[model samples]
Target: MTAVKFLSDEYLDELGDLVTPDLPEVPHVNVRLQFHATDTPEGEVDYHLVAERGVVVRAGRGLLADSDLAIRASYRDLLAFESGELHAATAFVTGQFAVTGDRAKVLDLMVVLQSGNYQRFIADLWARTTW
Candidate 1:
């Protein structure tokens, strides 16, 4: 799979679509995702992803004021996870990634991402897009 530009707005838009509508129906749940890459043209950078109650409240290039969960990973690791080349459990256990904040919410997000339906959706999505 071709990895999308981690800092591109187009990448953010696709990811926003992937997460926002399918988040677990929990009250007052908010998630913040930070994608870090050290070798980008602009030096180390962090891209932002924010979701609240199954809705993508914001997605761009900065952090939110407050978030219930924060998931951090290298840009490559994140793409691998998304493409199913790297399992999240393995990544977390092997120190390839990190999660901070509400453990329950983090797990919920994982469930959503790992679900069969979501996997199919992602496959279909990728088939239609260059990224």
Candidate 2:
């Protein structure tokens, strides 16, 4: 299968499909997370995920109205994280990833993000993404 450009319309469509099946059921992780990846070859890429009861109810380009968390980072850094070269927590700890939101919400969200299913989601994303 041919890979899609990162953050392309086709890629987002793929991500949207992955959400319902891939996301684990963890109600406490409910949150709207906005992701901003700046300085990409195609300029900036922005997206958001609205998860309720551990399932993503919405996924789309740009920001959501009331996100529980907003993560901003360089496209390179984000690519590294998604591609398995850098770990998400390591990126956050090293200041490569900037997040603004409730601390408790972050903890809750981490549960789902740290799950094995999430890892599978990342692997699937890596497979479909074009560097």
Candidate 3:
């Protein structure tokens, strides 16, 4: 399996546009994604995503003191999920992905997976990489 590199800034910028329009009228939540690339020799990468008031900002870090939500999954799973090739719920059920934190907040974030917009985003990204 090839290791995938996800730049926190780029990911957040894309996610911001997709999420802002659908966000509820509530304070922002800080969600940290600790990605463990299983097939890679390099260690884990922490992607910190802060979503609040219709804005999402991502920062690459080694650790976070506070994380309302944490998602643990391989790069391939993330690619499959974002590209709509895999269902997030099904992945969770199958133990391909693990999520920890406030269940409600986690569920709220998961709602985006059902929107189908992420597929288009992933397609665009894949196209760019091919060139």
Candidate 4:
């Protein structure tokens, strides 16, 4: 298990393969989320993930059509958010994280991510990911 560059094509491929489409034990909401990271060596990085009941079913690089939510931030900030050093809600309120699209979907996604199953899932991925 070599570490993969965060949000790189290989990383997205690996994440696409690893993410469960649905976690029956955890609450989930149907939504599509887009992540955009700026200020990287590669310029801007874009990825979209489709979730069916809170778990990612499809994750790919580039913009996704009709995403229910789009979240953007500097790569450094995103790194902190991913590592749990930055709380998204607080960051959003502080203007550190920018989010757009359906407000309901944003709230729903938050709920799903806070679930214990999702926490463990994120931890596993974080451990395997390279900064």
Cα miss at 12, model 4 (Å)?
A: 1.8
Q: What is the C-alpha lDDT of each candidate?
A: 0.61, 0.77, 0.52, 0.77
Native-vs-model 1 lDDT?
0.61
Q: Residue by residue across 1-131, what tens digits does model 2's lDDT show?
A: 66888877777776776566454477566878889989987788888877777766778677787888888999889888878898777887888989998656666666656677667876887787996
Q: Which whole-number lDDT from 0 to 100 does residue 56 have in model 2?
A: 66
Candidate 4, residues 34-81, lDDT tens digits: the string is 989899766799987776766667777888878988988998998888
TM-score of each: 0.63, 0.87, 0.59, 0.85
Checking candidate 2 for backbone clashes, the offending pairs are: none
Please report the candidate that would top TM-score against the real structure. Answer: 2
Residue 65 CA displacement from its true place in model 4, Å = 1.0
**RMSD after CA superposition, every candidate:** 4.1, 2.0, 5.5, 2.1
Question: In candidate 4, which residue pairs clash?
Answer: 28-53
lDDT of 3 by residue, 96-118 (tens): 87777765666655643343544
Give one clash count per candidate, in the order shown. 0, 0, 1, 1
lDDT of 1 by residue, 56-131 (tens): 5555665656666666677677667767799988987787877677767766566545556457756765555443
- Relative to the true structure, candidate 4 reaches a TM of 0.85
